[model samples]
Target: MNYTAEAPAVWDPAFADADDCLLSSDQCVIHGEHCFVKGLIEIPVIGSDEVFSWGVWVSLSRENFSRAADLWNRPGREDERPYFGWLTTDLPVYSPTTLNLKTNVHTRPVGERPYVELEPTDHPLAVEQRTGITPARVREIAAAVLHPGSGGHR
Candidate 1:
């Protein structure tokens, strides 16, 4: 399941107008009226290397974006890592169907920007990674901090 190549290049201007764009401290870009943001995720596979999925983009409301930004920059927040948010976006290269997933956004020192880790939850993919992951049925959990609802799923 390992990525055959490096991650895809970041598309700077997701929207036509650069003036309305805002990049969060964690590197999520918000632009146009939809508050669009893009990031990547790693999906675990049993008895195999993890798969890296890129071009994972979602659209959030202005208020939700603001809330996420606040949590991203909140002081004394080092104790609380991996902010969670409900972002709906299709995994272009994988599943073309849009998924309403709870994503964990965190920064990894190895990369230039942050990585958005997907919480398996009850998704079918979780079952596939059972043996490859820890403690039988136990799933990797993150703090349920950001609860930005699905503004748009498609």
Candidate 2:
């Protein structure tokens, strides 16, 4: 199960139509300054062999972004060390805001998006990543993401 946000919350929606921005489902760049890449934060689902994932964007330093872009299609890129990044998406279902959270963008082998690992913190999202969540929780997450103001409940 997964939910994907196409662009970071801070992004100006109109900027996508402008030539100054680089916009795609998997990556984004703004005026050559801010750079972001979409990666999966996979959380194991408890009581089952399943995973709940968020396909979210994380901001990377210009150098790291460039390095990632350079090796994006190359094999053996998975060997590179994880890049430190800041979460750029605001997942509103979480109470204390999911934006600006710390993360590590782990490069994968060819043909795969980077695996983003959230820093273990007290935040609910971070805790879920470390501990895992139940299927009921997964359904709630889906409801929250799908029903707007439902707050992940029936």
Candidate 3:
């Protein structure tokens, strides 16, 4: 599915409370002026494909990043682990829609950084639902949507 809309805005404090924010990944990094994290969500489409996994990226504040890192490093505190933050980001391969996703962060290999598992949400990309899509197809769509002419790139 293809869509054209105004570029999605940055994290809006009016719509969310920063104090209650939780990001999905613990491997967030500071790039230039912004902190970024990536995760994946499975979209339930109504066809032979049933579901497809799509990548999602989110922006985080310094405070939230520190909090997530502390929680991530704390030992023997599995039960009280934090849920991924409800912060914001533009969908990597779709229209600049504001997506609120549920995520589970976990440790990867012995030496690698932790990663996140983004769950399904009622976002437009999930609802639009396509079938028989290849990784190449997804990449192409993303390239088109994130191209210079496609609104303002996030």
Candidate 4:
């Protein structure tokens, strides 16, 4: 069985509150932010880097960010109401583990927006350099060898 010493929490729609929102199979209302549609947009996929960099960032649903944006747009909402959180990326890409990275877009929580770093963790390319893969010319040769059809090889 797939096992890890540190397993993550199970998906809980109830965890979504006014300050946080969790997208799941159903449109669940937790905290205070309401879901206008039920299971309409797949979690994270609607807002991921792959989609944002090439496609969905501009032409995607205006209604996607509508709720939080609408609340934020109001002046009184910022001061009076509880600050709702924001999805990590405007375009969240789905991963095997949890849903898309989410962060609190509030100022009340003190410093830093509640978002996850989108950088690669423990990059193989970075680690390979320490493994005696020195010389730019060697790297070029390896690259050409690995991907012959890339037109880098002779």
Candidate 5:
């Protein structure tokens, strides 16, 4: 998924105008929209390693969200399956900016407050180390990446 481009000429405004940055704390996808389950974006497989820097996005559908939440909370569920989480081979490389990893997790047990249990393979810690990105930041970036005509290239 590595897509290289010549260093920008005049700071291509298209990059700025691109519509990424879409996720919110409450809403995954806007109502009545066609959500997607895109691929995970990883960082340099070589070089310095870091942890807890990856994020996950899945087109923001109620169905996928519920499914992921269930798996995180309930590992014993029969429908549980592995999800994808990766690093960006390209981007608007900046901290505190959106552009994140994407994956799914299961819901936590009832009466134990609210939480999700992500599988170890898809763990944010491992993904971040591989990608050198933060989990929360990844989500923010993912929202932007998924935005229409944003040159997301993740």
Candidate 6:
């Protein structure tokens, strides 16, 4: 299953016009200030090789953002150390909000999005990230995303 956010939660295109901001499929810079990158918060399926991914954005320091951009197209960039970032997308599926969670952005191959590893906290999302979830959980998530008003029912 997959869920995606178009931009960082704090992003308001009305305030910052196109010239002032730079937003691409994976990179973002708001008014030359806040920096963010789209990454995947992946949870492995319990009994299979499948994965559930949340396509979310993470805010990074200017230095980290620059480094990531620099290595964006470089081969073997996946070997670089993970970059520390703050989760910028608010995932409504879980409680206490998914915003501002600590994360380690692990760069992958040139074309793959970075893997966002949530900090080992007590939060449900983090817990699931650490421990694989069952197929039932994936089905439930799909239900929620597909029909929110029905309370996760088909």
Give the alpha carbon lDDT tens digit for every residue of 4-108 in model 2: 898887788878787879988778998779999999999999999999889899999999999999998888999999999999988777868899999999999
If candidate 2 were superposed on the true structure by all CA atoms, what would the RMSD be? 1.7
Better candidate number, 4 or 6, judged by TM-score: 6
Off by over 4 Å in 5: 1-27, 32-56, 60-62, 76-79, 83-90, 94-154
lDDT of 6 by residue, 117-137 (tens): 999999889999999789998
Per-model CA lDDT versus the true structure:
0.43, 0.89, 0.45, 0.27, 0.36, 0.91
Candidate 5 lDDT over 1-154, as tens digits, reads 2222222112234444446422332223332343333222345333335322223333435565556544544545444454332222134443333333343432234322121122234444344434465455545556554573554323
Q: For model 3, which pairs clash?
A: 22-84, 22-85, 23-84, 23-85
Tell me the spans in candidate 1 whose CA falls farther than 4 Å from its real position: 1-14, 22-37, 49-55, 58-80, 92-96, 110-113, 126-154
Task: List per-candidate RMSD values in Å.
Answer: 10.9, 1.7, 9.2, 15.4, 12.5, 2.2
After superposing candidate 2, which stretches have Cα over 4 Å from the reference? none
lDDT ranking from best candidate downward: 6, 2, 3, 1, 5, 4
- Number of the predicted model whose lDDT against the real structure is largest: 6
- Specify the highest-TM-score model's number: 2
How well does candidate 5 score on lDDT at residue 81? 50
Model 2 TM-score (2 dp): 0.95
Higher-scoring candidate on lDDT, 3 or 4: 3
Better by TM-score, candidate 3 or 2: 2
lDDT for predicted candidate 2 compared with the true structure: 0.89
What TM-score would every model get versus the actual structure?
0.44, 0.95, 0.40, 0.19, 0.29, 0.93
Clashing pairs in 1: none
- Estimate the lDDT of model 1: 0.43
